[model samples]
Target: MALDQLDGELEDQEESSEELYEQHSFKIDGGQEPLRIDKFLVARIEYATRNKVQKAIDAGRVLVNGKTTQSNYKIKPADEIIVYSHYEKRGERIEPQPLPLQIEYEDADLLIINKPAGLVVHPGSGNPDGTLVNGVAWYLQQQNPEISEETLPRFGLVHRIDKNTSGLMVMAKTDQAVTSLAKQFFNHTVYRRYIALVWGDPAEDEGTIIAHIGRHKRFRKLYDAYPEGEYGKDAITHYTVLERFGYVALIECRLETGRTHQIRVHMQHIGHPLFNDDFYGGDRIVKGTVYTKYKQFIENCFAICPRHALHAKSLGFLHPTSGQQMRFDSELPADMDQLIEKWRRYVKAKGDLIVESK
Candidate 1:
């Protein structure tokens, strides 16, 4: 269907509200024919959801050439469009709460953090506060009152890690830094390494996994390797075994290409899935006579870390301004450390038993 038709459908569904509202104006330039309003909005606006765009269209909240049109409405070059939106005024401010943040390195360009496990990087649907972003904003403001809303570092975020994954992350302080760092990421020049504890030891000590990843057709939230070219992107991971328990192995993975959940998904593609990843959906426990000595420890560790056992261990990139190469590292969080220690003890105990039997 044509783009304007989609806009009409979107406009038909909007519900009117009595709350105070605001209006913003936009102009379309240098186009042959009218373009779909929704498509145009998505391109022009940052952080706008589909639902939000549709709602505005339906409410007759958007105008094309001074006339209300559907979300799919077409517009010509130089057409004037005004959008009525209900948004919190910009002058209102939110106070940042005091939260603990692990600062690894900091400079005028960016802040490097050893983000702890169990901490959300930013606020979202279920988490509105106590995020790494909030903490960073608070810390900056306290350090310099000059870092006001207008001057605040856009939090210059470059990348992300899962809430349960502990690791090194870089945040930009200046617009130039944000732009340069983003280019490095897009060019795949940023080097990232992660440490993961997975079930089972692979036959080979080191190997690479190359697969295309996309949303699972059956399950909406989880991602899986595409089976037959429906939806997926190229991903590459290289892993080397650091240590081995009776059943589990500690592996370090370097990313030649990074995709969402790349380490966990690629590890699962090999016979060894991460220790406790319910979303990938594995048997709750790995029970075998061969793993008897270490089974209890493994189960306990997995239970304690309900999320996947992956840590972003290191990050490397070129300084955006200085043109110097820099690298940062983060130690495994306490929980992961404890799990590794317990596994070591189990292996030692099992060895002692075997010697006694001999």
Candidate 2:
């Protein structure tokens, strides 16, 4: 809810290149007694001091039952609450250095990269150096020796994946590329797909999740699905199961509308969470047996991945300069690829433990 602290500890990149993001929702119990929303929230929300709640209210980011409410408004039972802030802040200055990059495709107007897991896309407060941005800037400097991070109008990233999520990213290299590609993202014409290993299989082999995602009221960094489209922007995700391991499922997600953490939130809303996604309560085992050996195996899996099992496996969009359609695919990073293999072996050894795959 608070931008200062969110689902993850990432600093804001350049302000002009950044967009405000929301990821945190709450619902009051029917029998709850009246209490000042801010006071009530402070007591209920973890790490949410009274001062922070008051400020969110003052900023008009606090909502009650789908309407903006002040800090002092007495909350009623069944009243849904939500808070929001810019996903990150422009907290620090950015400079360039010769950081490494895994280039996939590059042209005069844009660059496609196979970003590794744990790589921050840009310079932010917690990650002030050695980011993909820094690396790209350095690469650009080698060619022109005149362009620098400060001189660049924007970071050139049309969109971003999370720091822990691995996959393909296409960043713009020129002003024309920025405007054209950004428009594609805004128009929801950019085709994006993600691969994830989640805790459980879905009820359907394929389905769409359409919900208004907003910030979690209690957990400031997490999100909740508002089915009524109340608190946040509309988001749509379609998913199809590719494989199932009794306790987990490997699925593909197609984004029709891109929002922060869209796939993660939708999967969670459907009772499945991405494996090892610590922010959304996926670090612990959500499925599987209670046996010590199974528990140890899960813990081992966590150790292997250490981060959420998600990857931006594919992207397709029109070329900004040529207006020609472009598409790219990437192999899963080592951690996720190996994690799936581990599950595959476990399922095979367990025989009947196998869940039917779609």
Maximum-lDDT candidate: 2
The TM-score of candidate 2 is: 0.74
Off by over 4 Å in 1: 1-95, 146-154, 227-230, 287-295, 303-306, 352-358
Per-prediction TM-score, please? Answer: 0.69, 0.74
Candidate 2 Cα errors over 4 Å, as ranges? 1-92, 149-151, 353-358
lDDT string for model 2 (1-358, tens) is 4432344334222111112334347888899888998888787655667876776666455678767788789988888887653333333445667877889999998899998989988766567788887788778768777664333333565577888889998877764565567657766888888999999767788899999876665665566788898776678899998988878999999998876677888898889999999888789989977799999999999999999999999999999879999999999999999999999999888884655554
Lowest lDDT block of 10, candidate 2: 11-20
For candidate 1, give the lDDT of residue 258.
Answer: 60
Model 1 / residue 274 / CA error / Å = 0.9
Q: Which lDDT values do the candidates have, in the order given?
A: 0.67, 0.76
